[model samples]
Target: MPTLLVTASPHRDEALGNRLARQIAARKGGDLLVRDLAAEPLPPLTVDYARALTLRDPLPRSNATLELSERLIEELESTDRLIIATPMHNFGMPAALKLWVDYVLRIHRTFAPTPQGKVGLLAARPTLVIVSSGGFHRAGESKQPNFLTPHLEAVLSTLGIRAPEFVYLEGLVGRRATPEAMIAEAVAVLGDAWY
Candidate 1:
């Protein structure tokens, strides 16, 4: 499968989420496209880009922002599977990942606005989200609110990605478990899901 791996962690080599995503991609064994958001951060949305989406006319590709948006959408559309590895930043998505989301969630390109509501235009695909956090944030066990998962779910659903699977590596700062142990558990969980 053609896998698109989008990683947003600033930790680089030490990011467990990114490491796990890479391992999953390797196991899937296909053409891998890695978008390291920290290494190459996307620009924040400009007023022109926002206005372009609202226009009834086709978006002008001549605009640099629109061009980048189109390219990001194309990457998402071409992927057979998508893996997003990110660290939860202050109970929500990091700036880089949110920027990527802004670019990909185009008005006429990825979704259509209807009288009832916005409708997704893209096909649903296999998507996995790997989220890391310094504290526990898994439903009932959460010590704090988790805005990241809900936001991502809604955003991906808007782009026609239904029920994307999520894996969490929490309590890294608290050291509830060693990094190796946590990763092994996560890997085992994934293997079980696939097999």
Candidate 2:
């Protein structure tokens, strides 16, 4: 089964959920692919990119940027298990996540253009999202905790994926907590998932 770990943080070595996913993959005898969006940034959608989209049978132009975008989408379509580890920013996801979404959710690949309505091309799969933030956001508590989780859920659901399992590490600041403690909490919250 294919597994994907999409992360936003610039520092690849510091994500707690990434570390957890690695350990689980090692034990399970599988490969873990971490697509660091920060390292490989997609260009802001341009006229050329739009033109390529309109073509019935498009060919990659000299820029080679469209080729990279297609490769990224292919990887997402193949992955059976997915993990998105992100640090909540401004009560939402970082730009890296948004960029990845822009690439993978392309037409004629991840979705189909239908006369009735938009249809998801992906099969239902399991996804785990681990969110870390300095503040707290409870379902029925905390007036101004964060808006990241809801947005993530909606996007993933639209892609024909199962409801994502969420692990939120809140109050990371001034908690006097160790990284181990935080990871253990995450494991507890998510249980023995695909990791």
Candidate 3:
């Protein structure tokens, strides 16, 4: 199976999310395509781009503004499975990852607007999200509200991805357990179901 691994971590070496994603990809054993958003960040959407998306006419393949969006959508369409590895920023997802989401969640391309709501056009696939946070965000132990998971779940659902499995590496800042230890434990749990 083809795997699309999208990583959004500023820290290259010490990022637990990225490490766990790579481990998951290795265990899955498939053609891996990595999109490191931190290394190659996407530009913010422009007004022209926004207008173009609302047009009834088809978007030209040569349009420079929509080129990246097109490519991102193509990657999502071609992948058998999708993995997003990101660090929570300000209790939410990183801006880079959010930009990626904006690019892929194109109207009339990935989804269709309906009277009821939005309907997804893309085929559903197994989606795994590896989130690394400095503090606890789980329901009972949370010191802060987690806007990342719910936002991602809603955004990805617009593209037909349902019930994405999330593996969180929480309490990485002040916790007694080492980050490495937390990552190892998370990986062990994932191993039981990821295969």
Candidate 4:
């Protein structure tokens, strides 16, 4: 099976999610492709790209905007399992990661609009979302609004990926939290899942 690692943490060594994603990918043992959004940010969604995907008539072959979107689509379609490593930023996804998501979830490439509603085109698979936050964002202890998991789940599910496995590393910001301990806990969780 083909596996794609989508990493978006600005933190290189310290980013817990990115490290966990790498560990998971290494253990899973399949064809691997890594897209590091922080290293190479994708172009934000533009009108030209949207026109290429949604136009009534086909656009010219030489349009660079369409080409960019097409490349992004190919990356998404070819993956069997997807691991998204992201740090929750200001209660949501980082700008680079959000842009990458926008690029992949194209109109015709990932979904089709029906009379009833939007339907997903891609095949369903196991999507692992590794999230690290400075504060707690889980059930009763959340100090922040978590748009990260919900937004990511909704977007990926819209493209036919369902029930993403969420692994969270939290409480790194407060006085009492140790990032190393949090990382150890997160790694233990990963060993239980997708190993």
Candidate 5:
């Protein structure tokens, strides 16, 4: 499968989610395309851009945001699979990833309005989300809000992607934590889920 791995971890070299995402991609024989969001941060969606999107007006030739938005959407549409590897920052994804999502999930491009409600235009694909959290956020162990998965699932589903398969590397802040154990477990889960 053609896989697009969009990573948002600031510490790309050490992010366990990225490591496990790579393992999953390799196992699936993925023709990998990486979008390093931390290195190349997407601009926030502006009111003008949002207006343009809603009105369906073509931007001028020099509009950088429009150009980038089109490019990102093109990449997403071309891929048959997607993996988003991100660390939990304040119980949500990083700003760069959020900006990327803002750009990609546009009306008339990836989705459309329906009488019942808005519906996705893009074809559904297998999507995976790998998250690394210093604190435990899994069900029953979570004290903090887990806004990341629900937000991502809604946005991805809105764009016609399936509800994502999630892999987590959690409980890294505690003294008893062994990161290696978590990494191994997440990798094993990826293997089972994908293969």
Candidate 6:
């Protein structure tokens, strides 16, 4: 069976997106993996980090962090599907999730440089991202999406994953859209075929 990994922070206590992610995992018929970035905690990318990763040498830091990074990558490589339940924090993703991305996108691992251009090392896979926000900000409406949608797409594309399907649940606090309504929308959108 394939696996679905949902990375996010549950600080808001909003399980709508997370519940939808679980449904997707069930549809995929895989071992569901949920890694709360806030709980697991990934460090920010740094110069030493790049050096250590490129050289395949251990960094003079917490071994646990490095091991978690390795484990995350291994899980990604093995999984057939991925679902990202992300909440927009200050118009972008939480810092923890960004750190998780940094850890997985290693040089010569998730991607490699080619003579023509950078080539993706990961196999093409299906990814469903459920993004929740408190306001409406479509592509042309906002500038901050660059750090959220495009960043994920670029990294996933670099790893050979393409055509990611993202479900945007906007205006949860306003527009009279309660958490229940948002969750219902997500669940309906994810349907049985999504995974």
**What are the lDDT scores of the predictions, listed in order?**
0.87, 0.73, 0.87, 0.80, 0.83, 0.72
Q: Show where candidate 5 strays beyond 4 Å.
A: 46-48, 174-177, 191-195
Cα deviation at 25, candidate 5, in Å, is 1.1
Candidate 1 residue spans exceeding 4 A from truth: 58-61, 191-195
Give the top-scoring candidate (TM-score): 1
Write the residue-wise lDDT of candidate 6 on 1-195 in tens digits. 576566585653345566667756775675776677756676666666666776766577765546766888888887887788887787677787878878887777778988987788888777888887767678665534435787778878887889888887776655566666766776666645583
What is candidate 3's local distance difference test score? 0.87
lDDT of 2 by residue, 87-168 (tens): 8888898888887777767777677778976677788777888787777777664646577888877677656675788887
Q: Which regions of candidate 3 deviate over 4 angstroms?
A: 56-62
Residues 10-104, candidate 1, lDDT per residue (tens digit)? 99757999888888888879799988899998988887788798767756566889889989988888888899999999999999999999899
> Could you give candidate 4's per-residue lDDT for residues 58-163 as a string of tens digits?
6666677667767877887888888988888999998988888777787867888889877889888778998878788888997668998889988988888988
TM-score order, best first, reads 1, 3, 5, 4, 2, 6
Candidate 6: segments with Cα more than 4 A from true spot = 44-48, 54-65, 139-146, 187-192
Model 4, TM vs. native: 0.89
TM-scores, each model vs. reference: 0.93, 0.84, 0.92, 0.89, 0.90, 0.81
Question: Worst ten-residue run, lDDT, model 4?
Answer: 172-181
TM-score of 1: 0.93
TM-score of 6: 0.81
In candidate 2, list every pair of residues with a backbone clash. Answer: none
Candidate 2 stretches with Cα past 4 Å from truth are 54-63, 113-116, 140-145
Model 6 local distance difference test score: 0.72
Instruction: Compare candidates 1 and 5 on TM-score and give the better one.
Output: 1
How do the residues 1-195 of candidate 5 rate in per-residue lDDT, one tens digit apiece?
799999999988577788878877888885899999987777777766876787656565566777789999989888899889998999998888898988999888888888987788888888889888888887798789989999998899889887789888887666255667777777676645575
Total backbone collisions, model 6? 0
